[model samples]
Target: MRPTILRNIAASVGLLILIAVGYVCFWPVPVEPVSWQAFVPPGYVGPHAANTRLSNINLIEIGDEFGPEHIAIGKDGRLYAAMTSGDILSMDLDGTDQTIFANTGGRVLGFDFDASGRMIAADAMKGLLAIDPDGKVTVLADRVSADDPISYANSVVVTLNGMVYFTQSSTRFDPRKWGGTLDAGILDIIEQSATGRVLAYDPATGNTEVVARGFSFANGLALGSDQQNLFVNETGRYRIWRVDASARNIDVQASSSQARVLLDNVPGYPDNLLRGFDGRIWVGLFRPRNPAADSLSEWPFLRKILLRLPRSLLPTGKPYGHVFAINEDGDVLDDLQDPSGLYPETTGATETADRLFIHSLHARRIGWVPY
Candidate 1:
């Protein structure tokens, strides 16, 4: 009787193991991961060498608000920050006189001021929005057609000629339905669908048209000093692209003189691109590359299996804070890093004559360091 009972217990444990294996192997996941070779991460070396330069940043408290994702100095000489609560807050450079400028009722990832001083916002859930000086909000473009709507509007740049260019991050995973911006982005990147796009909106005719497509996750937009070239961040693939501003409906994947990768195989996941002082474009490395993710990149089935695990087991961005400035030639000019990662997600920096205001995705206060 004792022998029989021990055998039954062993059998039960074996059955449980089989069930777990089957679930991990066959369970459906949202991402249909594509097989691609991930470049071996260039560890902190050369221009991107490790440093403690960003360790001593000062904070600009925003009271109860958090996640000051994108910031810009408005034409009125005040700093405008788009918070996670959908409130656009205006404050003095010293973090004083903070006031709610406008609320778009959607998560705004990036925004820029137009020639008319209206804030053009790339709201992740609400599409392209324009907020007037008096705080009236308007939806400029939400859909390309009745059937195709903009899923993730991100990073906007208003040219001097009144053309508003913005990035639509992923067509497959909507942030609203898939938790939020960061989660949706993870799904899209893991899937490698390259559904991201660049679009142009003409306020004159209320018409929006596609500029370029075929980015894994098209983020961050900045116009060249000539106003003829647009610098775009393709986040998932760890690169930046320089696309001709006039190129219409161009596929970045196909060989085209219209779009070319300017920076390739950077050490980390690049986020926003801000054109800063003296022809330097500032870029933030949101997270360092995960070797496990890279190793699975060429194995689509394994990637799917990996996603079947618990959400907590999935690889996420580390807290390491890093941001850098680059020239048009793709040379790293300044690299600031906080290995301790005390400042959270440093998206990029807004450079004034004297300070570099660091942006973050989850920090309660805006960080700054002397320029």
Candidate 2:
């Protein structure tokens, strides 16, 4: 306990602190983040108030299956779940009669049934694909530009005439190397590069065309009842865009009338879109917006420094559950929530005759509420 002994110990601690600071400040990161003005989220209040309705729902266990990100009702009237294990699960409404209908060997974020009863998936890793009734998988469109490609192919919807519309969540973060789908999404939103796009793939000609571009993180997609419009979720900016389905190319902010914001300044990050039988479109708010992140949106330096720190220390959205239904005019008709978030990360919902199947990004079991 001499002065020299204490001095040496203090010196060692000082050096360690210096090294840690240097690593955090000078480390190179893959994303070159940009700053954008992020509006403060309207907290859960009034119609969007917190409740336990979703938390008390019945859970259909998927055994070891994790991350049932999306659900679909096939032509056969059975439930199909896109699981994190890279397998599309076919089962009854009660979670029985489970079968691995098809394995895409990649993540299927969203899928829909084509007129021919083929399951079309927007695979984050493999690209757009088609799975036949017999479990045969086929790559439909892996890349539009061999150079830049569809980096993060996300939610998809099939038009009655066989056109497939999907969203590429980001052009900067490729889910393949950016540490999976969720990680890549975080990077894209943090970067705010606005490179996300909407695309159309035609099966007849085997061609793909850009429908709309310049989105921060285009996530989910749903066609309008008329099939002439498409609603897309832009996660990074907390908005949903309406794009002209027939437009071959257009920027969201262009002078053309092809693209417009359907719903701006959402309360949280919108994930997926599902058309309910009630003539309303259900939208999933993946995570409640973080106040700290919004406050730092205009501060590029602060965001970049935070990104350089350990991800665990970074500001992130809360798990407060929220989802709502909106009419074609973007009027919110229903808001359901569970502030306790028993089934966290409610990504989307699939409505049927007797129940509403709640989708989650990382839940072990699928949740359902008697509608």
Candidate 3:
């Protein structure tokens, strides 16, 4: 073969191989089998009679040194928090000097612990990330829409098989535009596409599947104590939906299986959810969907037109902080409001021995709130 011809042939072969590998690496691998449910709970007014308010609430302002999003309290009585700006920090019960434990170079949101005590985070800009005590970072679920680089990791919880059930708060919004679209409320969903769902991330096989879909804005995720179903909080719809992770091997029929809502309108929009040792679910609230926002949500056709404009030209809404205490049955028990109103609403919660730690994405801090 001529020298130039040989070189051209070699280059063509390399390009073909690259294209093949790229296709496999970046494909929307559909859900293996989905459990589907279309039931939504009736709009709730307030806490049910069976649920009671949590008292003796105490707050600790862990300054800008350690900004937090979601919180996790390990077995060692130490609290770990995912910071929105770029790092995860550890703090003591008395709001002591917080220390940076993990630096993922992305906004950290939801997190949970594995059997081995490794810290897993639902990073907003990045996908799922795991951090060991030494601060080693690992990418568990690197992308939601793998081929598209569509990432919006939110809240995460671990199962026995080291699998993770998590949420991607909004598919229409990514970290690049988070600051511009963070609190769009119901209007965003009405204006944009409804792209929210719960996902199953298997570490052993390095696989991620969308187990449930059709949510307004999926935010928090948690497994029932019995492990019967994985619950996801759809912020825009103002409800929580349950998915049957066990049915993945069975069937993917429309009516065969369903992801049902546990509770809706717990007096405020639920941001992140956690099941406590006592059977109650601790949820972080970004804020109640401003009724005005909800009213505006009904006009998506018009809002959709506005979103196409430059972000700087849009009217960004205000931000605030809120928390909710709900029981195992999905009933709101008490409302945790920000009396000080210094920082924006919270994302996750952690319980340290006698204290409760919270992550404030809008405020730069990491610390505890008296339970």
Candidate 4:
């Protein structure tokens, strides 16, 4: 009787093990990872060397709202910030008399002011939007056609010619269906399908055209001082690209003179690009590079397995505050680092004469440091 009982127990243990193995091997996941070579992360050295520069940030409380993803000073000189709550709040530079400017009802990751004082916004879930000065919201371009819609509209810049250029972070992963921008972005990066593209919309003609295509995860955009080149942050590959604004439907993957990598092998995931005063472009490193994620880039199967594991076990971006400024020549001009990451998800900086307003993706308060 004892021998029979022990055999039954052993069989039960073996069955449990088999079930676990099967789950790990074939369980469906949202991301279908693609194999790609990851660049070796350059440890915080050179211009990005570890420092306490961003450690002392002054906070401006926004009470209950969080994730000030992008901030732009309007023509009226009031600071406009796109919050996570879908409310664009306008306030004084010192954070006084804050009031709701407009609510797009969709997340606006980045925005720019047009020549006519309209706020051109890149809405992640709703596509490109235009908010007039009187707090009226309008959809500029949601889809090129019924079959081909903008999946994830990201950053925007309106040229002097009334041409609106924005980025579609991924054509494969829709943010609304995948549970917001960050989650969808992670899935797209893991998949590495490189469906991100740069598009231009002519406000006069109400037409949209592709300026450039083929990026792993395009995050940010900043028109150059000359307004001829568009600086794009390709987040998945940790690099910044300088693409010609005039190039139509240029594939960045192919050997094209229309586009070139500006900053390569960044130490962290680049988030937003803000052109500052005097030809300086500020870039926010959302999170420091994860060595484990980089290692799994070449092992697509392992990445899939990793995703199948518990969310706690999956490799994720560590909270580290890092932002820097670069010139058009790809030279690092200023670097700020906060290893403690207390200020959280520094998306980028908006530079003024006296202060540098830091943007974040998950902070209740806006941070700023003396310029």
What Cα-based lDDT does every candidate model obtain?
A: 0.92, 0.88, 0.64, 0.93
Off by over 4 Å in 1: none
Cα-based TM-score, every candidate: 0.98, 0.95, 0.75, 0.98
- Backbone steric clashes in candidate 1, count: 0
Q: Name the TM-score of candidate 2.
A: 0.95
Candidate order, TM-score descending: 4, 1, 2, 3
Angstrom error at residue 172, model 3: 2.9
Name the TM-score of candidate 1.
0.98
Displacement of residue 309 (Cα, Å) in model 3 is: 9.1
The residue-by-residue lDDT of candidate 4 on 1-371, one tens digit each, is 69999999999999999999999989998877888898888999998889999999999999989999999899999999999999999999999999999999989999999998999999998999999999999999998777889979999999998899999999999989999998899889988988899999999899989999999999999998888999999999999999999999999989899999999999999999998988899999999999999998888888888878777876767889998999999999999989999999999999999999999999999999998
How accurate locally is residue 19 in candidate 3, as Cα lDDT from 0 to 100?
80
Relative to the unseen true structure, what is the C-alpha lDDT of residue 141 in candidate 3, on a scale of 0 to 100?
A: 74
How many clashes (backbone N, Cα, C below 3 Å) per candidate? 0, 0, 7, 0
lDDT for 235 (candidate 2): 92
Model 4: CA > 4 A from native: none
Put down candidate 3 lDDT per residue, 152-186, tens digits, no spaces: 77788898767788876666666556453364333
Candidate 3 overall lDDT versus native: 0.64
